[model samples]
Target chain A: MPVALEIVSPEKLLLSRPVDMVVVPAEEGDIGVLPGHAPMIVTLRGGFASLYEGGKVTTKLFIAGGFAEITPERCTVLADEAHPAAELSKAEGQRRLAAAEQAWEAVDKMDVAARDAALAALQVARAMVDAAEAP
Target chain B: MPSLKALRIRINSVRSTQKITSAMKMVAASKLRRAQVQAEAARPYAERMERMLSELAASVAGNKAAPRLLVGTGKEDTHLIVAVTADRGLCGAFNSNVGRAVRTLVQKLEREGRKVKIFCLGRKGRDFLRRDFADRIVGDVSFAGKRRIGFADAEEIAVRITSMLNEGGFDVCTLVFNRFQSVMSQVTTEAQLIPAPPPEAAAAPEAGSAMRAMYEFEPDEETILARLLPRNLAIQIYSALLESAAGEQGARMTAMDSATRNAGDMINRLTLNYNRTRQANITKELIEIISGAEAV
Candidate 1:
């Protein structure tokens, strides 16, 4: 049995299909899942989710951090935002990274909540740049 | 009876108004379709997020050290209402429905001796509530001329609310918006945002109980909840914004449809009167001319 993988974003479902194997960018580390993987819930990081079918990588998605719930037969990733790696632009990613840096600096140090938000935005910006260059 | 020229002008004005209302009706109809598609597209993510949260929150509902977002500050004194509406008007009562719902909720909470604050999300809501509850409105964010309302906008609003939660702005927070039911119906809904309400147990409880799997938390429950809760809040607000936009379009379509019909009726009446008056003037002119000829 193949693993049913569903990658959903705030705007829509990006992908849903059964694949031979799937690798997710978990907070702990990159984890690979097959059909019978143990049930686990992990927060995701800003990186790529590579899905393999027939011993080849069929799809690669860049996901901004959210979380995933992995059951025995299914893996559901609720992404903050997602785009096909092929669709990303290096210049756009670079611009976002620069803006994120400025935003991070502009946030008041006394405000922990804003600081956390800026850091998260920076992480996504960095990941987008990296993904764009390599994808 | 009015002169023929005056009657003609009245008919022409009513005809122009009818054209404008009918054009607006068509525009609103097309926009409503687009908004409904957008709202539909965003549903899967929202439902998945809600279900996952419900399952996770069910486990930590009674924990003493639970995140305040999940369990509140353990008080019910202050209430914050995050109400959303359209920025533009002429959507029938779509904006006012949300405004009035917030009004009633504020009054009810105040009568119970609870301190109430408003976090108005759109201009119309602020405009409606400003008459009496201006002081109660702590913040108002309006996207008056934005090309489109996107997830980033919702995230900005969600971030502010979470920051307010951290700063002890209110003990409990409730989100009020008009939920789109159909083109002709929008239900005003109030949902508790902070102190995240537990998922309803009655919904598919049997299926859940039979196949519930014991799962391991990757970074553990508390850490995951801390991250997921805020993200969930943003998703909730995003979906609400999308649905409210759809409802606004739906309301506008219905309103414009009736306005167009009313304009048609007025034009019909004016044209009938104009034709009758023109015929009457012709008859009087012919009588005067024939009488003058006979007298001559």
Candidate 2:
């Protein structure tokens, strides 16, 4: 059974396709969606989501934090930023990673909220680097 | 009498000005198309968010221990204003209208003996607000380098606002922006963002369903509300930004259209003056030559 997936941003719709399954980066952990999953709403962390098609799963995007709403018939991701993996530049990712690391190290001197934010950025940057370098 | 060279130069200058206005009009129209689409697209998400939040708020309203963000912090001594405008100006009265509305709000708030702090979203807003409320401004955000408005930009502002709130920045937060109505009119609106107001009465709970739907909160109501409140604020900011962008375009199109027409009128008037002056000169020369021949 095919599951309808839509990835939307404020400006425009990025992706709307039917796939067999999807791996979403939920706040707690990665949540996998199949055709008949129960209705659920989860906060998304900044990371990558994979969409599976017939006998092939494609790693399509890096989403920068938002939410995912999954119903039996469809799954929708409302992300802050979503770009195709192929569009991710290795140099940009590395630079961002370094910045995140510096920001994280200074997190201790920052307030609780800033520290949390720095950590989230660190996670996203690291995820991007890893995803871009993956074979 | 103006020399032929002077008349030619004047016409050339006016033509150049007309060309610039025409080009600006075209650019504004193209941008208006994209901005309108973005503004329209944001409406559904905002409506859904309001619907969902109202449902949640209605359920939580009965609870005495509701989150502070919903019922507010129970103080009105301090206020924060988030004013959104365009980074660039050319749109007639677009930025100024918003600036005027914000000024009115600020004065009213001040008269009530409340302290005001400003969070400016666009460069134009910052420039205007700083003129009067310079000391009150806590933050100023601008996407001057950005090619398009995106969630990341909104999120950055949201994060800052939420952090300030968590740190006890202000008692109330109000958003002042332009609501895109059509190509001819954009209304400036001021809305309360913090201690989120009860959803508008028109959008409130429907009467047909006297029975309330029981909702099972996944991570507990407080946790969900805590997370959702900040996100809702961000969404509101994002919506306002989109509306202002669209409104700016609409205003520019209207302004430019009038400017182009006005330029045409000026060119016509100048051309008429030039023609009459030249004809008078030719008539004077003819009369002089005829008198000289008759005298000879």
Candidate 3:
């Protein structure tokens, strides 16, 4: 049996299909899931998630921090922000990276909570750049 | 009988008013469709979040270490009422209904000797509540010029409420908004925000029940709950905003439709009166001419 993988953002559902495997970017580390995997909930960091089918990567999605709920038969990713990696252009990524860097530089002026949020945003921006440049 | 000139002017004025009402009705219908689509799209995320939070909350039901948001602050003497209404007012009693609900709630709370703080979301609610509850009014947030309601607007309100909660501004928070039932109906509702309400037993999905027993958290449960509680608050606010947006459009559509029909009826009546008056004048003139000729 294939695992049902669903990626949902606040704006809309990006993907919902039965895939052979899914690699989620958990907060601690990347976790790979196949059918019959143990049920777990993980906090997502800023990175790309790879959905596999027939031993090939079917799609890669850039996800910002959120949560992943994994059941044995299904995996649902509720991302704070998510977009298809293919939609992230290099130029756009670079622009975002610069903006994030500028914001990070001003993080010192913000409170502890705002600074932490800014750091997460910067990491997501970097991940976007990495996803855009990947072949 | 009224003069023909006066009746003709009245008919012309009524015709123009009917034209405006008909145009408003069409505009409201289109806006309602868009708002309905957006509200429907936002439901899945909000429902899923609610479900997940409820499950986690169920597990930590008796734990003392659970976040303050999930568990109450051990006091309920103070209440913060967030009344959400529309910025504009042509939608019949949509705003007034919400205002009435809030007013009733406030009166009840005050009678019970509980302190109440009113936070108005839109201008209409603020204007309505300010008349009687001016001293109780704390803050007002308006999105008057915005063409569309978005998550960002909700987030801003959530942030303000969270900050106030952190400062121990109020013991309980209640959100008052119009729940969109259909284009013809909207029911005013009050949802508790602070000391979040316990998840209902039926909220857990049957399919996820088996997996629920074996689920493990990556970090600690407390850590996840702490991070999730604020986000859940924001999600709840966002969904409420979406519902209010749809409700506003729905109410507007219904109100405009009635207004348009009423204008049509008035125009018809005015035209009929105008024709009758003109005929009376013509008949009177012919009768007078015949009378003069007969006398001669």
Say which candidate scores most in TM-score: 1
Q: Write the per-residue lDDT of candidate 2 for residues A1-135, one digit (tens) a residue.
A: 788998876556778889999998887789998988776666677788889887667757888766676767788887756788888877888999999999888777547546766877888888888877875
Please report the interface RMSD of model 1 to 1 decimal: 0.8
Instruction: Give the poorly placed runs of model 3, Cα more than 4 Å off.
Output: A89-115, B202-211
Candidate 2 local lDDT, B150-190, one digit each (tens) = 86678778888877876788889999999999989999998
Candidate 1, B1-296: lDDT as tens digits: 77778878887887787788778878888878888888888899888887787767766656899898888998998999999999988889999899889989999999999999999988999999999898999999998888667888888898899889888999999999999998899999999998787777526667675444477788888888888888788888888888898899889888888888887888788788888887887898999999999999
> lDDT of model 2 at residue B88?
92
The alpha-carbon lDDT assigned to residue B42 of candidate 1 equals 88
Number of clashing pairs per prediction, in order: 0, 0, 0
Off by over 4 Å in 1: A106-117, B201-207, B210-213
Ranking of predictions according to lDDT: 1, 3, 2
1 or 2, greater by DockQ: 1
Per-residue lDDT of model 3, residues B112-149, tens digit only:
99999999999999999999999999999998999888
After TM-score superposition, what is the CA distance of residue B277 in candidate 2 from its true location, in Å? 1.6
Rank by DockQ (best first) = 1, 3, 2
Quick one: best lDDT, which candidate? 1
Q: Each model's TM-score, in the order given?
A: 0.95, 0.84, 0.93
The TM-score-based order of candidates, best leading, equals 1, 3, 2
